[model samples]
Target: MDSRSLPNSSKSSKSSRAEVSVKRSPVEPRVSTLLDVISISMGETG
Candidate 1:
């Protein structure tokens, strides 16, 4: 979300993309677990 606030100066475009990816790495495991849990919940609901 904050990424939208990034300067459109052009110079930051490449570097900001890399920063976003790096920031997402730590949440990968948690996101995976959440997806698995959601799948199981959907199966039960259906």
Candidate 2:
């Protein structure tokens, strides 16, 4: 029981971590681009 539970827990944790990273991967670039655009616009206006 302990051995089975150990692998299961590890697999779940790894999958959850991978999912979080994958979700953030695309979002981070979008947010960075938005910030860059905002900064550029402000610079031009200023």
lDDT of 1 at 8: 55
lDDT of each: 0.86, 0.97
**How badly does each model clash, as a count of residue pairs?**
0, 0
Q: What is candidate 2's lDDT per residue for 1-46, written digit by digit as tens?
A: 6898999999999999999999999999999999999999999999
TM-score, candidate number 1: 0.53
Give the 10-residue window scoring lowest on summed lDDT in candidate 2: 1-10
Number of the top TM-score candidate? 2
For candidate 1, list the clashing residue pairs, or say none.
none
Candidate 2 regions exceeding 4 Å error are 1-10
True-structure lDDT of candidate 1: 0.86
TM-score of each model, paired residue for residue: 0.53, 0.63
